[model samples]
Target chain A: MSDEIVELTASQAAAAVHAGELDPGELFETYRARAAADTLNAYLWVSDRTPAGPPAGEPAATSSPLGGVPLAVKDLFCTEGVPSQAGSRILEGYRPPYSATVVRRLAQAGAPLLGKTNQDEFAMGSSNENSGFGPVRNPWDETRVPGGSSGGSAAAVAAGLAPWAIGTDTGGSVRQPAALCGIVGLKPTYGACSRFGMIAFASSLDQAGPLTRDVTDAALLLRHMVGRDPRDSTSLEFPEPIELPTREDLRGIRLGVPDELVGEGGGVQDGVRRSFEQTLELARGLGATVEPCRLPHAPHALSAYYLIAPAEASANLARFDGVRYGLRVDSGADLVSMYSRTRAAGFGPEVKRRIMLGTYALSSGYYDAYYGTALRVRTKIAEDFRTAFQSFDFVVTPTSPWTAFELGAKLEDPLAMYLNDFCTVPMPLAGIPAISIPSGLSEGLPVGFQLAGPAFSENRLLAAAYALERAIGFDSSPARRRDPGGSTP
Target chain B: MLERAQVDHVARLARLELSDAEAERMAVELSKVLDHIEKIRELDLEGVPPTSHVVDVVNALRADEPTSSLPREVALRSAPEPVAGGFGVPSPGAGGE
Candidate 1:
């Protein structure tokens, strides 16, 4: 059963469970055994066991295609009565009384959650290295990191911890890690997925996406995840279960490859560049018109993202004062000291750094100077995409410049790590859909290529990504960390 | 150069107190970040509106409508030290008094 069911794709597992070929109880036990031996740091908090859903013995619901599949939810999602730490000491025992709308949707759809995966404190870092529980070791290699702040989710999917996990991408958090960990991840068009219970990092940039073993499963998970939730007023009113484009042909697809982004010099690694070139060759082979375009303001994306994200983070995180919720420390003789000490100890270094940077950006005298101008730059970047899409259906680039590096290599140097988002960050700022799928392996590490589509073009983006995933013919069949206890990070 | 005083002030505003080493290191790193972020000073946007959000959509929300209650005690279960009705907060000079 473990041989047949354990190796199945999320959709395949569901089919077996639904067909009475696999028992939901045994299936849950199989995943539970795997998670119980977790040393990958992929999980933040895991349940000892999950109840076999529906019929007491058989697969439960008819509403879900992924009804009984075990999956992990990033700790950033609000789960009812479950301790969602948000990878911080602040919310140590925070069990929100209510579940997020997405969680409700998943439960209603009958996808049984395995546990909460780790993330950067409040979804901040590119490398899960920023997590307070320590870095989630890349399932591929013990010394390397899983891309973060959704590192736990990425690593989980990469190592078969769960078939696929739900993740939140704010400023490339989901896709970047997805790229590094060698899995397919999608950040649907900004307002597509409801953000009712996901912790807000940058409200404008934060969108929920799924990480999966393949695009079809990703498409299925995404279908269930999107739609309007009255709880999240920011959610858009989309048709129920928004159908993604299942286009078999790219004969009319206008693929744009920005020469500036296709780094010629030594900026991009040779293997990654070659992999992207090979991917473009596949797209060209598919009869898609591929050409070079330019977005002049593209270079300043990182600078703008740092300012904008931190500014929003500063404001959004202000609600976590040493009051109401989160870890409260009683220091000195006053409310001010208590607040100060509590936060100082509660938040990790990265979260505090952004809070400080954001507090400064949003400060009175600097508002017009820092936060204000970065917005203009963000607008310029968005305009760059809007202009490029005028001649192109989708913009393509390498998901991240380099593969997963050693865990502690860039954590101390903030700028070097922030550059990981050099290419992917701009898309979220434009509120567009971007997907990261395995292009190929560079040396021994995985390389991911992304497709950026204009707002409401998820169907197009998914179709292109699906075509690439099939044509590229990439697969990491051998699970990297079969023995989780051996990993270091 | 940023002084310990300025660092202290920033920390106070941020509700953080950096250790001496962290403060000194932050002073240097933040100065560099500030140098780059200060480019905004040169963009002449006398009439251009400052955009705070990207979607250009207004939040459609309603005033608070209470429906369910947490039975008071269930909500207060996790508070470190709580007053009967609310969490206890220390007043300034309470220790001295």
Candidate 2:
């Protein structure tokens, strides 16, 4: 019975809590036990402190929609008194005195914090292998990676350890891993969620979002996660409260499938191609008019992102000098040497690599050639989305080029790892809203179908995603037959 | 391909210390990434203006009224070396800077 309750979607769990049929404390215990048994290394810290939820049998005291449900957060969001490492050793043993705006919002919504989930160091890598703690294994196959740097969040939800998890998507960190792990991940338009109290990676691109078991939960969680935050100047001021309308049919909706995304020479893998084609047919049956479209600048998006993101990272990461906070190597006699030594010892290899690349690109003589050109390319990419949105309500593509690969497969090859974000990076560059929902399975692994819309069109995007989610009906639960140390088929 | 000396130079500018072997490896890895991203240069972007941000709002500011701030103890909670109610660091001149 506890197992069954833990398997409910976040929306279902919230509904159960609202009805006084389930206790958040009991739910927390079940998840805590499950988290203790987690071989995936999904959680970096599990909170032993129990939260105060509505007592059993009484109606929820607040009008907040989420009732008293349990949710896990990625380590990036600062939780008061909890270690928010952002998966880097630099911030080890450091605890924030105050909570992030998003964290406070979730608590106000009546969601209990299960723990802080693992992530890539400073949310910099695609795979969780870059984490200072360790890589999070895929729940389906323990040998494989649960797509990252939100891999831990994705794995937790997929394995039924948490109903939903909050993760930040800088460059498909949410969507790519959600797709790989057979779940729902939404990267709201940039600035839709507050960035205050979240550790900085690339300030321009960083946005916190929800990774859940289904589209409805993603929608429900997002409503509470978004709003105008005075603390975050980049936060958006919406004309209407962000609401996910209960949508049924997709009649009269226009979904454009980009030709470049599915071209022969592109990155689309064989399994992902088959799943995308089937999902397209499913959309057609749901009354969505699917048409071929073009995003000509997408080919250059990954390139522009590599340069632009790193350049911003170099500046954003400068605050980690040994004096203020975090790990400080004190062997040096002076500040400069101490700064270098601390950073060298604290940051992982990938973090150092990007900082170096960014410094080189932003250097005096080379700025115009690398960072300057990348910015121009970014403008063209945004233009590409603007033109496409004029005709199509949403642009559709496979969330990732391929399903989740084995752990450490591309760790040695930095270029190969960067190529994984080929399909997902453009949305972040354009600052548009996109969601990755489970479309179908490819050789037992989940394949994500992505739908992207222009800035601030999350309502329409989520509605369309919900309609297709029902039509396709891909299972969100991990494959039991592949569970390590259990019975094999 | 980027040279080892160039990688070391960038490391110094970024305030990171890398071993000789790591610098050699970084040069090779960064060159591969650079090779992949070189395709962007093929595009003829003549007059497109750069986009520093996507939001329409610019210069958003608050009034001059002072507000409550994070307490001193809270702000210095994570400091590696806290001294006299603030963070402490080695003197700049100590390392001959």
Candidate 3:
């Protein structure tokens, strides 16, 4: 029973708990055991404390739709008394006194916390190698990366350490890792999930999302995670709760295939290209018409993102100066020296590289040329999406140019590392919702096909993904799902 | 490529104390990033406006209401150096060379 329960998706576990067929405490213990034996290093901090279970008068599992399901949170989201380091040394040993808005809501909905997962330092790196603790290995092949900054969250779900986990997407942090790890990752529209306690990466592009085993689980998690919050002035208010469309059929759904993303010079890998083309066929069989669309400005998205994200990150991360909280290095020479010394020691190489780039971009005379140009290109990218959406309900792309690369392969080359986000960055730049669902395997690894839609079109976006999910018939549980105590193959 | 002097200037503005080696390395790497993003300059932006945010945001002012806030102790809980009910920091002149 424990073995079967461990294999169940979040939705399945929730249903079993709701029906009184599975014990929530037992389920929690099962995940706890799996986490204890985890070889992937997916969790940064695992809570030893067990679930509180139902209150005095209420019956078990009657709490909420997600009641009794165990889930892991990305370390970026603040959990009271739990380490929320955002995978950087600067924030090591730091724990928020209060839970983030999303964390609070998940607890209210009765999803018990298993632990906080690993991530890129300050959610900045493409690979989890930038983590202050260590890199999270891909469960599929240990030598490969699990995609990142949410690599641990994706790896956790892939490794069955947790039923589902939460992640954040800024330039495909959530979706890219989800794709590489062979799970479903949904990045909700900008302002959909309140960012109150989630550590800031790029204020404009950062949005909390879910990395789950399947589309159904992604929708269930999103329903509970999103709502308006007065704390986040950017939070979008819905007059009514966003209802997820349950329609599985894709009849009459029009999916736009971006010509630039799929064209000959798009830099897509051979294996990923084959799987993506097969996915398009699968979509066609599901009664959706795939049309060629042009995002002429998308070629500039990677360029724009590098500037815009770092520019915003430089400002948001400025508060980390040794004065307020977290790690502080004191030189005793002066405040300036203390700040410089603290920051120099606190931030990792990738983080410093970005901060330097951002500082240069936003500095005196260069601001108008670098950041200014990037912002204008960003508008053009959004306009390109706006024009594309007028004719198509959704746009599709190969989630990344290729499958997960080796762990240390791109670490030394910053530009090559940044290119990993080439295919996924445009959606965040446009502030649209997108999901990466496993299309199929390539060279014994998984490839993800991304489905994106206009802002507030999550229901449609998810519906299309669901239809494709059913059509493609992806097995979330691969044969590589290893025992926690065993050495990684 | 960015000059080492330019890297030094940016690091000072960003308040980071880069080592001699790090500044030299940053000069080469940041130059590559800047060159890659120079693709943005290829676009004709005669009438295009810059978008600071994707969503159209207005002030989301709330009712003038007071609510219980995190206690001072709680707020100061994560501070690496805490003093009397707040984060402890060196005085302004303490780090002066």
Candidate 4:
């Protein structure tokens, strides 16, 4: 049981711990040692070691689901008393006085908080190359990127650093990296999870979800994570206790393949394309009908997303002025100089670039031309998805353009980096639920299949993903991002 | 296309400084990207209303109760250098030249 216990999903681990066959403390110690191993650079910081000796006794239901499973949160999510840097110098060593609602929920569910994983400063970049800490390499290839800003979380889970990690998607931050790292990631309907503790990037678009080894694991962690929080007003009121079933229940479902999406941008990698098509065939064999569909405005989605995200980021990130919390720099003896020095010295290159682009778009002269126009474009994209979903149960696309590229390959060019989220941004703009499941691999890297549904359709989406997950049987073995023993190349 | 001078002005508005070489490079890159985005202007939005949110709702809130503030020392501790009254900083509206 101990041997099987190490590889079990978070749900399985909790059940075993409840039955007394496994001790929570021992499990915590094992994961800590794995996180502590130092090869992955997965952790920005880990809390003081808590062994499997005795519970911290926080009084959470010990027999409840996800009890005692260890999980890592992306640095962007604030954890009380933990230095929440968002992988940027601007927030250097800054500790939030409160845990994000998501982080708080995990702790309440008895999943011991593992350390925070590295991320792009303010969750701005696709490659994690923009992070102040350093890029988190894919466990599969040291030279390649892990796909980002949730890159650290994906790499950690792929390398078996932990069974599950929480990541935010404001674009493809969660799913793209999960796809690249060969993991299961789900970004629920925009309001499905509360954002009270998440540091805002683009308030309207940002979402928090899980990255796990498999769909069952994703389901277990998400069941505990998604909820209404008094602190986050955007949180949705859904029926409580969302439960997912084993693979056998997914027959006769409907999946829409938008012809407009799949063939554009040259679609996915060939190997991934083969793998995804095979998975589609597998679904048909299992009784799900697959049909070509249309989403006309989706073609313009990437353009509008780039504009809208920056415009919102310009306003949302204005809180980091020298007057408030986080990094502060001194200079020039005047109030304006004070702001310039603090922001210039604190924010990373990518962060500043976005802020400037956003500021320009929202600025007086350009506001009506740029930001205002982008919002109109965003509306059409949303309406397109709404109309398409009426006829199709769900829409599917290859999660990203290709498998993970080499680290620093796309870093120098900002446009190339922004294009990484090209496929995943439309759903967020539409305020719907989306999930990425490991469909297959190209060469050695993994590819992801995306499925999106109407708002609050998470249960049905989860059902479809679960059925598809077992059918695909994607395997990403020995994905070690950092082997302190120097075993990986 | 945004001119080289426009890129410089935008950078200043955003409080960033770029070397001449970096600025020139950025001019080329930003122009190309924005040109790609020029496609948005082609949309016939005629009377469409702009969307400000996706998951729309009023602000989530707690009672307007006062919360504890970080003590003066711990809160100001990360200041790169501090002054008598507050954390130090550069002039406003732009990074100091």
Best prediction by DockQ: 2
Ranking by TM-score: 3, 2, 1, 4
Instruction: Output the number of the lDDT-best candidate.
Output: 3
Chain B, TM-score, each prediction?
0.72, 0.88, 0.85, 0.83
lDDT tens readout by residue for model 1, A1-489: 665566787887888777877776677777777776778888978878766454234336443567578778999898888988888878887998777888767766767778899998899898888888888987777689888889999988888778789999988888988888889999988778899888788988899899988887788788888887767777876544555447666788888887666666216888899999998888888888888888766777777789999988988887776667877777554877777778878888888888888887777777867787888887778888999999999999998989989978998778777878888888888888999999998887899999999887777778888887888888766554366455532
On residues A153-266, what C-alpha lDDT tens digit does candidate 3 reach at each position? 999999889899999999999999999999999999999999999999999999999899888899889998888899998898743465554776789988899988878757
Candidate 1 lDDT by residue in tens digits, B1-97: 5566776777877777678887787777676666655654565446565455555567667568877767677777766776887876677555322
Give residue A372's error in model 1 in angstroms: 0.5
Each candidate structure's TM-score, on Cα atoms with residue i matched to residue i, is: 0.94, 0.96, 0.97, 0.92
Interface RMSD over true interface Cα atoms for each candidate: 3.1, 1.4, 1.9, 3.8
Clashing pairs in 2: none
Local accuracy of candidate 4 as per-residue lDDT tens digits, A158-211 = 887787899999988999999999998888888788998798999888999999
Instruction: Estimate candidate 4's RMSD in Å.
Output: 2.9
Give DockQ per model, in order: 0.45, 0.77, 0.72, 0.44
Q: Scoring model 1 with DockQ, what do you get?
A: 0.45
What tens-digit string does per-residue lDDT give for candidate 4 at B19-95? 68767876777677778777888889999999866766776676888877668776566556567747654444443
Off by over 4 Å in 2: A53-63, A479-489
For candidate 2 chain A, the 10 contiguous residues with the lowest summed lDDT are A480-489
Looking at candidate 4 chain A, the ten consecutive residues that score lowest on lDDT are A51-60
